[model samples]
Target: MAKRKGTVFGVPVVVALFFLGMMMPTSVGISLGGLRLSVYRVVLLVMFLPMLITLFSGRCGKPHLFDALALGHAALALVSLIHWGGLQQGLESGGIYIVEFAGAYLLGRLYIRSSEDFRALARAYVVTVVGMLAFTIPEALTSVHILHDGIAAVTGGAPAPYIDQRMGLERTFGPFDHPILYGVFSASAFSLAYFVLAEKRLTNGRGMALVLGVALATFLSASGGPYVVLMMQAFVAGWERVMGRLPTRWKLLWALFAVIYACIDLFSNRTPFHVFVTYFTFSTVSAYNRILLFEFGTAEVARHPWLGVGLGDWVRPVWMSDSMDNFWLLIAMRYGLPAWALLVGLMLGLVWAVGRRKGLPEPWKRARHAWAFTLFGITVAAATVHLWNALFVLFLFLIGSGAWLYDARLPKRIGQPPRLGPPAPRLRPPPERLF
Candidate 1:
């Protein structure tokens, strides 16, 4: 809690470095499309320097399940790269991929070892949401994206990459590649704000105001992606209230309702997947492209079931299909189905770990709800939008940190430390959990 330069080696400093790197701005920038290697990446590399030192000095511990999954995903990407892009190109691209995404997870796993440490990151996210508003609010009202202008000024790129007019208004993209992605980023930050600023946790009135401000900023982003994510968060909140606390008959009634809905979708020839396609059709171009990409990309993944195509290879199949906006399909098309499976397995595992109804304490239960919402938001947004570099890495970082928290709060026998490096005991008694 001490805000001083001398405390840079502690957990709080991790938050400092992350936000500094994220907000480093493109005024001193470089833009190679999504792979822009600019000051932000440079600062992340610097922030990562200490972790690299610790890791190489034999100070790190055994790999957690999520860590292993990340390593597997990285290795698979490398193999896919070598097959599709050649060994040299693979090394270059795959090296960057691993360093940015996998390295983020590694830092979280080794350094952010507890809920307190994770809160440091959450606090930084809440602050970044406010900082983003300084730019985004202007963009929304006056239709000027300052960060976009700065990127153009420094890198000689387009004035604003993904700006578009829809329904008589200009979509304000802020610092992200697209308007929806900006909304998704805001939505993610809003989830972090909920954890960092619970109702009674902050005495000042700013906590409530900040939460509302994030919600407004998210709404003003004028994109459906974040709206869907917000709905998911609301669903999680409502579910938390009645999920395990409900009587068996009430739970059965909800289950029957779900079954009836599924049956309706099936019999009416509107499958669940079709429901997503219909519900996510907020923008014609993005929705059409997503459907086209999903249809073509799935076939491509089937074609090359193991090591999939190079990043640019699938573009020749359909005109303007250069970007697979959905992250899961992107992975399946480029790396292979295995990578997708591994990534999804890790996320689902986190959801299950947190949703366990056993003697979950108040704090851990809240962590579970927040983390589940994080996973749900990420999953929903990834299906409609794409993020780049530091932003994308931040997604992977949360996945790792959530997994770590789930492991840290697992119930243990009296006098034993919380579970670590082992699977949850199948037959242990309901035990206490940490807040």
Candidate 2:
């Protein structure tokens, strides 16, 4: 197959629509049979069939372990929903859940089939975050969510309120429902923007400027979770660049963390995780509540391990709010440990799988590094905060998008001789190139 000519708008229609839909709040959705079909949900559902068809066409490549895990997670969610809510309501809600989860995954799997496609995705990601600054900046300064407030004015729905101030600035919610969600979504593009764009295409400091733009947007949210994500991305990027020469650098890094964790667990008054939660947070109260939440939340998961409290409240102190801040724990508390495991497994498994692949050109190598590290940041951040709606779908979409890296084989040179092995399967041709 000839080298694919990936354009900036390679996945133009769906990618554009996906980001555009996300810019609108959930309040701006159509009501169909008691189900509020949000903007992004509609986009996913509309494209779900075509994406599914493309996936099964063997166009991308043979399915991998993550593919099975994604489908299995969706299936478990459907079954759990039915088991909890009676057949009609269960199917209604569960179907949307599948659409959000599996549908988003398939879109990423089908559209991003090569390094060029991945590049296009990365550029789109950075562009989207940069464009979001117009509203986020004003929202951060004014403490008024401009986008949501405007939508609420017309739709007669309540606008998103200003979150608690951090560092004397109101947390910027941007177009998302929460400031943390906005920050998490924006922070994801940090590694991609820096590694993919700044490292190669925009080497003249313009790329670094773009990365700072993304960083500024993430900071505007002023949320702990997003800050953690930003810090992790920076750490990963630095570690890889400085330690790329050492073969056992990763193992050494792991051992170092292990030793630190052991020392903290043994010597500190609080457990390692508790200490981690306490120090990483902006507010002492939040840290304390999160610790308490983990304590109570895990107990609830233990009580209802099979099918979690299913839209029902988990047991906690009367003074504590019903919200579960931790996304990973919330999954176990709501859907059961199996569901949480499958979802997490799909994420970390793909990151590990793609990271292990070798012999790629600079672009592909950076692409893998960017995607893997981005997920690493999100994985740790999720422990500190919950993701929902657009952010949740986006999280899965990113995981699916990286699936291409596992099977990708970019030519080392223009006319490199074929390797001594069975011929690699031909990649499905990309769609018409669009800038």
Candidate 3:
């Protein structure tokens, strides 16, 4: 078998473009005189499309499990478009989310061709996150400028005067449009960083220092839901390591802790230290909020059991009196039960594939393990926040990359060897002619 040659520029270029796309300022919209382009949409065009072309042109290999997952998402998007209405309404609103997710999956499939590529991508992610945190930490401590802007943006237009009066201290939002979102994004990144650092020995002191900075960022972000999700992921990882098994008294203990924590958070207005300790000591309010939102969303699902009340319409003012934070609810509201079912099946299938392919080689196996837990954390986190965004897309790339790494290691099916025969025996006459 021929060994694969690594491209000097391709992978790094893709990683850089992706990180830039995520970090680019959306406020300064891409513009040409009267016309303005969204940074995100442009990012999709510049980063993802060329990469797809490269993959197909290179005949990289057959599509792997993550490819299958993208197909499933795309299929669901297409179905929603056809059944619910045309592209403008269905695709533009609800369908766009799926498209972005598929884009992430495609990018992941294209860039992650080998275990080394997977590791490199992970390192890039860690670096990008740490950089963001480095900027945010100083901003968080010195002034409330970032938080004020985030609140204003999240509220849509200017925030109400009363909102400022009520909160007293300014909320800390970091770089994101909302504080909660900032927290969620930071938590996921921090958790992944932890996993990456833990898996490999950090021989380089600089790498270890960066990981520590990321951990601090996670702690300070203070978004309740993601923090809880990270804790849960840590517990799951620890449990997986200990006893070499899942399902035991420890699971029960964790569940009980979660329930108790939620009860306390809901009923009490404790001090910051108390809240922090209680939140971690038990299940927490974040979990309870998810349950409530999911319930509320399900009730709406019952109303429109078949086709949903149009994409984006469910969250509109007329549909419900309150916000629906749960991801399942969001899906059910946009695409109805059938689409929701397809999504669930896709996620479950991915989880099963990761679990079944546990014995794959290094970096690949480690990546798969990280992805499985990451996805689990994502699922839990999504119950309290939207998972269809640029950050989530970045995450999908990591997951798809892991799947591709696994596929790369698998033995090829039986096939005939190349038919080029040994060089024809050199004749004495030929040798004399050469002389």
Best by TM-score: 2
Q: Per-prediction TM-score, please?
A: 0.80, 0.91, 0.70
The lDDT per prediction is 0.67, 0.85, 0.58
Model 1 backbone overlap count: 0
Runs of candidate 1 with Cα error greater than 4 angstroms are 1-11, 24-36, 43-61, 151-158, 166-169, 199-205, 242-244, 247-261, 315-320, 357-361, 409-435
Ranking by lDDT: 2, 1, 3
RMSD of each: 8.9, 9.0, 9.1
> Which pairs clash inside model 2?
none
Superposed by TM-score, candidate 1 places the C-alpha of residue 16 at a distance from the truth, in angstroms, of: 2.6
**lDDT (tens digit, per residue) of candidate 1 on 13-98:** 55456545655444445556445566646555556667656644645554456566777888888888888878888887887777
- Colliding residue pairs in candidate 3: 257-283, 258-283, 261-283, 261-284, 262-284
Cα displacement (Å) at residue 388, model 3? 4.5
Candidate 3 residue-wise lDDT, 1-435, digit = tens: 233355333345655666555543344345554333445546555565566666557566765554655666566656666566676555455444554666666676776776666556666666666766655666556544453355446634343122121123333455554555555555555444555554634564765676576556556555555666566667766665664544464566568778877887778775332444334422455445545555557777888776665543443335344555566678777667876776676666666766666456554556665666666776766656665445566556655665564456564434847659898888765455554
**lDDT by residue for model 2 over 82-170, one digit each (tens)?**
88887897899889999999988987887777877788778888988998898888887888788778877897777887467888888
Any runs in candidate 2 off by more than 4 Å, and if so which?
Answer: 1-8, 200-203, 415-435
